[model samples]
Target chain A: MLRVKNLTVDHGAIRALHGVSISIEKGQLAAVIGANGAGKTTLLRTLSGLNKATDGSATWGDLNVLHSKPESLVRHGISHVSEGKSVIPELTVSENLDLGALWRRNRKESAQSKNEVVELFPRLGERLSQRADSLSGGERQMLAIGRSMMSKPQLLLLDEPSLGLAPLVVEQIFQSIRDLTNSLGLTVILVEQNAIGALKIADIGIVLNLGSIAATGSAAALRDDPAVRAAYLGF
Target chain B: MFEFVNTLLIGITAGSIYSLMAIAIVLVWRSTRVVNFAAGGIALASTFVGSTILEITGSFWIALPVAMLAGAALSAFIEYFFLRPLLKRSGDKNQEIFLPIIATLGILGIMKAVLHFIYGEKIGVLSPPLSDKGFIVSGESIALSPLRLLILGIVLLLMIALTLIFQRTNIGLSLRAASFAPEISRLSGIRVDLVRTVGWAISGAAGATAGILQTVNGSGAVTPEAFEFSLLLVFGFVAAVIGGIESLVGAVVGGLTLGIILAIILMYLGSSLVFFAAFLILILVLLLRPNGIIGVKGGRRA
Candidate 1:
C-alpha cells in the first residue's frame, strides 16, 4: 500500500500543493483528475521524489520515501512514467527497455524482463532495433509504459498517458491499462486532464480543485455526482 | 604522388589521435552541455605528471596509468566542484552562452600556472624507452614507432569500446536517457550526476593520452625557446571544431586533415603558418558544415 500524509509542496514562495492526503491499496487503479495547474503532476512528482515535499511524508509500506533519492525509488518498486514522451529518443527501442530494467542485477532476469515487456507491447517487439524518436505518438506512449514495466514496479505512477492521442488510440490505451491491471495486479496512480476518461476507468476517483482535493469516491459515484456532472462533465 | 600517399597515411594516423581527444570533448559536451575549453589544460597537467614520473622511474607502464588517473581525478574534481554549482545558474540570459567558455579559459590559465609551479619552466622530452622503428614499404620508410603505433591502436580500441558501452550497457542507457531528459531519467532511477562525472573522467583520460602522445612526438613540451604545449592545445581546439565539435570522427579526421594541410603548407609558408593553417581549415569546415561531417543533430549529447 502507498500513503501520502498531509503532503505540502512549495515552489519557492508559490504553494503548488497544500496539505493534501491520499492513500492507495495494492492493485487498485486510483485516478487524480484536475484542470490545468491543479497540482496533479506535482502530487505524482512528489510521490516519485522528483519534487521535495515542504511538509509531511510519503510512506510506501513502512519505509519513509519522502526524502529518498529517485534512483532508490526504483528499487522500492515505484516507477513513474513522466509527462511528455520521456523515452530516450536516441536509444533503440530494445535499449530503452533495457534501461528500464537497469536496477535488476542478474543479466538473465533482466533479459527475461525485457522479453516480457516486448510481449506486453508487441509494437515495441517489431521495432526493437528502431530509435525511440521514430515511433508515432501512440507508439511512443506504449514504449514509455513498456519501458516503465521493464523494472516490474509494484506501483506505476502514470501522468497524462492519454494526452494528445486520437479517440481510438485513447480507447486502445485505456483497454491496455485495464488488461495490465487485471493480469499483472499492478497498482496505478493515474493523473489526467481528461476527467471523463479517467473517471470511467479509475477504480476510485479524486477530483482536485486548485491544489486541493475537492471530492473523492468510487469512480461510478463521481461520474453520477450532479456537481461533477455540471462543472466538469459537460452535462 | 608517392609523397602524397605517405603524407595521407601520416595524416590519418594523426587524425586518429585527434579523434581520441575530440571524443573526450564530445562526451563532456553531450552530458554536461559544456564544451570544455580547459581540455588541453587538463591533458597538459596529466602529461606533465607522467613525464615527471617517467623522468624519475623510467617506467612507461606506471607513468601512463598514473597520467590517466590524474586526468580522471582532475576532470572529476572540476566537474563536481566548479561546474555543478554553475548548473543552477545555467539559464541566466545575462551571462551569455560564452560564460562557460570564458570560465574554462580561466581554468586554462590556472592550470598553466600550476603546471609551471610544479614542473618548472623547463621543456622536458618524453621518451617511452620503446622501439622507435618504422615499417618500410616500397623503398619508403614510415616512422611507425612502437609508441606511436600503440597510441593509434589504443585510440581505435577505446573508440570502439566506448561506443559499445554507450549502446549496449545498462549504465550507458541511463546516461543516454538522462542526457535527453534529466527529470524523466531521475524518475526511472538513474543517477544523472554520476553519469556526467563518468563522462568527464573518460574525456579527461583521452586528453591525457593525447598530451602524452604529443609530448613523445616532440610536438607537446614546455620550454623557454618554445611552448609546444600551447600549440598542441590550439591544434586540438581546431581539430575539435573541424570535426564539427560534436562528431568524434570529425575530431580525428579534422586533426589528420589539418596536420597534412599544415605539413604541406609548411613547405611553402614556413613554420609560422602552422597555427594559422589549422584554424583556417577549422573555420572553413565550420562554415561549410556547421554540425560537422559526422555530427548527429540531437542524439547522445555529443
Candidate 2:
C-alpha cells in the first residue's frame, strides 16, 4: 500500500498542490482527473519524487519516499511515465526500453522484464530497430508505458498518456492500460484530462479542482454524482 | 597523381586528430550545453606535461598516456569544482553562457603562465619514434612516420570504440539521453552528475591527444606560445557545428573536409595566407549552409 499525508507543493510561492491526502491499496487502479494546471500532474510528480513536497510525507510500505531520489523510487516499486511521452527521440525503440531497466538490481531480471513488456506490446517488438521519434502518438504512448513496465514496478504513475492522440488510438491505449492492471496485478495512479475516459477505465476516481480534491469515490458513484458531473464529468 | 595521393594520406592523418577534438567538443556540447572553450587550454596543459616529462625520461610512449590521464583528471576536476557550481546557480535560462567560458579563459592564462614558469620561455623539443621517417606506398614516397600513423590509427580506433560504447553500452545510452534532455534522464534513474563528469573526462583526453600530436608533428617542440593554438580548436568547433553537434559521423566528415580545404589552401597560397584562406572557406560555407553540412535540421541547438 502507498500513503500520502497532507502533501503540499509550492513552486515559488504559488501552491500547485494543497494539503491533500490519499492512499491506495496494493494492485488498485486509481485515476485523478482535472484540467490543465489543476495539480493533477503535480500530485503524481510529488508522489514519484520528481517534485519536492513542501510539507507532509509519502510512505510506501513503511519507507518515507518523500526524501528518496527519483531513481530510488523505481527500486521501491514505483515508476513514473512523465508528461509528453518523454521518450529519448534519438534512441531506438529497444534502447528506450532498455533504459527503463537501467536501475534494475540484476541484468537477467531486467532482461526478463523487457521481454515481458515486449510481449505485452508486440508492436514495440516489431519496431525495435526504429528510432522512437518515428513512432506515431499512440505508439509513443505505448512505448512510454512499455518502457515503465521494463522496471517491473508494482505501482505505475502515468501522466497524460492520452494527450495528442486520436480517439480511436486513445481507446486502444485505455484498453491496454486495463489489460496491464488486470493481467499483471500492477497498481496504477493515472493523471489525465480525459475525465470520462479515465473514469470509465479506473476502478476509483478522484476529481481535482484548483489544486484541491473536490470529490472521491468509486468510478460508478463519481459518474452518477450530479455535482461531479456538473463540475468535471460534463453532464 | 603520386603527389595528390601523398597529400591525401597526409591530410587523412591530420584530419583524424581534428576529428578527435571535434567529437569531444560535440560530446561536451551535447551533454552540458556549453561550447567548452577551455578545451584548447586544457590540452595545452597536458601537452606541456608530455613534452617536459618525455624530455626527462626519453620515452614518448609512456609520456603520452600519462599526459592523457593528466588531461582527464584536469577535466574531471574542472567539471566538479568549476562547472558544477555554475550549473547549480544558473538554473535553466542560458544564463550560464559566460561563467564557465570566462573561468576557462582564466584557467588558460594560469596554464600558460605555469608552462612558462616551468619550461622557461623557450620552445622545448619532443622526439617521438617517427621524427624523421617515411614509407613507400604505390611507387611513391608516403611519409608513414610511425608517430603520425599511430596518432591517426589511435584516433580512428577511439572514434569507432566510442561510437560503439554510445550505442551499445548502458552508460553510453544514458549519456546520450541525458545530453538530449537531462530532466528526463534524471527521472529515468541516470546520475546526471556522473554522466556529465564522464563527458568532461573524455573531452579532456581527446583534447590532450590532439595537442600531443600537433606538438610532435610540427617543429618537434612545444612552447608557452605553442599553447596559443586556438586555430585548431576553432577549426574543430567549425567541424563540430557543421556536422550537427549530435552526429558523431558528422564530426568526422566535417573535420576531414575542413582539414583538406585548409591544406589545399596552404598548398596553393603561401603559409602567410593560410588563415585568410580558411576564413574565406568558412565564410562561404556559413553563407551557403549555416547549420553545417551534416547538422540536424531543427532538433538540437549545439
- Taking all chains together, each candidate's TM-score versus the true structure is 0.91, 0.94
**Model 1 clashing residue pairs (backbone):** B15-B256, B19-B252, B30-B301, B123-B222, B243-B250
Docking class of 1: medium
For each candidate, the DockQ is 0.57, 0.53
Off by over 4 Å in 1: B88-102, B128-148, B219-226, B285-288, B296-302
- Candidate that would win on DockQ: 1
Cα miss at A178, model 1 (Å)? 2.2
The digit string of per-residue lDDT tens for model 1 on A207-234 reads 8888888888998999999998787777
Residue-level lDDT tens digits of model 2 in A1-235: 8898888999988999998888888888898997788899999888788889999888888889899878778778888999999788888899888888887747898789888988888899999999998998888999999888887888889998999999999999999998999998989999988999999999999888888888988988998999988888787
lDDT of 2 by residue, B1-302 (tens): 66666666667777777787788788777778777877887888888888878978889888888888988899888888888888879865657886777776777788778877887866766666564576766565575666768778778878878878887888888888888877667667777889999988988888888888776766677777763357667777777766766667878887888777666656666578866766776677678766678665676532
